[model samples]
Target chain A: MNTERLTEPSKDELASGLRRLGAMDPGPDFAARVMGRIGTAAPLPAPKRRMARVIGWLMEPRTIRVSPLGSLAAAACLLLALGLFLKINPGAESGRTPAGLSPVTFVLAAPSAREVAVIGSFNGWKAAGWTMRNDPATGLWTLTTALPPGSHEYVFLVDGTTPVTDAAAALNVDDGFGSRNSVLLVKNGDGTAL
Target chain B: MDKPDNDRDDAMAVERTLSGEREAFAVLVRRYQGPVYRLMLRFSRDEHEACEMAQDAFVRAYERLASYDQRRRFFTWLYTLALNLARDRARRVAREPLYRQDLDMTLADPGRDPLASLEAARLLDALRDLSPKYAEALALRYIEDMPLDAVAETLGVSMSGAKMRVHRALHMLRELYGKEGKQ
Candidate 1:
């Protein structure tokens, strides 16, 4: 593929220059600006969806990790994961909350909108009993309710008919109606909120 | 993202952010501004566009934090999300013009990158000529210093696929550099 041989920069040199791009920095106020958009002392918590501390325990480069540990250790890790999953996610497949409902909180930060409601698979996509409570001081709308441990899809219905996507959702799926709905997994945890 | 020791700290910060700690989320933003900003630069027409796109990516990631698979690294997830936003931006904004222009512009405007070596500049110029996917593969592999597995995970490709892309990318970059010999 070489029409003319070039020896200015070898592969290693080219690779080195490319890697230097990784060190480019942004403006000093970058973080503050981001916070300004999210708010510093707002009235409500960031959003309803959050914190998989256990999940973030694994970082990017760790994907290639291979330990010389025996298969027994692997099995133990698997068993621990399964136990943790079952413990953290009781309402996973059953879609029922026999161990009692988990408190699931959802927040929508819509200041301009006059009304907001949450409609999802749990409520059959209806907002009848899911009208959200708004705080004028912060203009953040919040809704905390108990749901059986399981997966759920929802959206914030701003005003009355316009559906808005939850930017804070753990997962968002196609709504099949030219829009997207946020997804959340409610685990069978303690008195803590999901 | 590569720092194993930071994993626990990242987890803690992420947990705080998820728990509605806005300030905690700022820690992540401040921490990752460098690589994230650099990543967005490839997809933008200029630094301003890159900055806007990078910020948008973070806000979107914050919005979709719940959707993130915990098994993956936060930076990986954030990088993937930023790439998606860049793609979406490409469709809507219709930008990412020729890379040679960027080279010329940066050289002419010494304030932009006064320290850029000619060799380094030419290499970057050729890189931008490759297709987005190929460039992305090379960037992830060499620039980001990601393992093949991490590159595969970021690109959503199998390990073999990642290897193939990298191979092809290097060949293509070599051809482009050869053409530069005429200049």
Candidate 2:
């Protein structure tokens, strides 16, 4: 057997030799050729229509949905229906009131000289027949109107148009856009009056 | 080795390509095509097959550029893909006895002195006689002048493993040369 020590080649000798053996210069126009092929190759088709179809299917009814706007609209309609029912049916138990029945009563207090009336969500907030005469001796104005034992709001009319709130009213609600309304929550059949 | 300067350059080129300069991608294709093609040739053992595999690897790399973890070595990833394709080709070759006659010296150098070309061819033939893994290790080590670690990365193995493969290949080559001397 031939026995000889193997010696390592210098870096320069190794590099130039490998270069000559085709380790470098991949070929002329290699990059341009590759990029040209890539550019000219047919592109993958997009799935926009398929995606839109999927979205449409998902958005269809009977699928899961959390519609805040629809829920809000339903809530508003429910509230409107409730308000209408409450207006038409003030006292749920009794509908007939004697012309002079006067069993239902409404009042508003004005310490100064003025006139008062019962006006509410029930009677469209008018003060026609239910006006109170001011007693000059006591300087207090009081009105009593036969309301059908349900919730209503009333206030004092200082000459004709100026409406004053009743300080002693048991119920008051803020009118939200920055005004105040006196609310009277009257539960009928409990023998309560306001 | 050079503080990943070439890799940084590759990433910049990739970025430029994605930013609508398709020409930038060509620069990358040009730069790495040699290594990638050589690696594929070692695997396929045929120029045409190697060229096809290399092209496939590059196209695949371009398509999946977005998924490439730029923090890692790009060639390693590309070579892995090319090697896998070559392995598939090898498996197919093993299954089917489809062989082409080895390129003759006459064809390799039609005009050059036949004796010198024959010596270079002899060295290549000796290298090819080694097991595929060992031959690849030797080729990448001496022929390509790649670092042991980079060769391992390309071959998808550990450094010590690649080092051992190269060491074993050299021992085999010496033994073969010794045998030739005795004859």
Q: What tens digits encode model 1's per-residue C-alpha lDDT throughout B75-181? A: 87888888888888878986655466565554244455655645555666677678889989998888777789979987889999999999898888877876775
CA lDDT scores, all candidates in order: 0.75, 0.63
DockQ of each: 0.20, 0.14
lDDT of 2 by residue, B4-104 (tens): 88888888987776666767777878777887777666555555665777787788777767666667777677666666776777777752221324434
Two-chain complex of model 2, DockQ on C-alpha atoms against the true structure: 0.14
Q: Which candidate tops DockQ?
A: 1
Q: Which residue runs does candidate 2 get wrong by more than 4 Å?
A: A1-26, A41-194, B1-3, B95-101, B105-113, B174-183
Candidate 1 per-residue lDDT over residues A1-194, each given as its tens digit? 24222444556656777786665566899988877776644323333333544445544346566576866799899999988987686445345544577767788899898999999889998889789989998999987677777788888999898999898876889888788888888777763432
**Per-prediction TM-score:** 0.53, 0.49
Consecutive 10-residue window with the lowest summed lDDT within model 1 chain B: B106-115
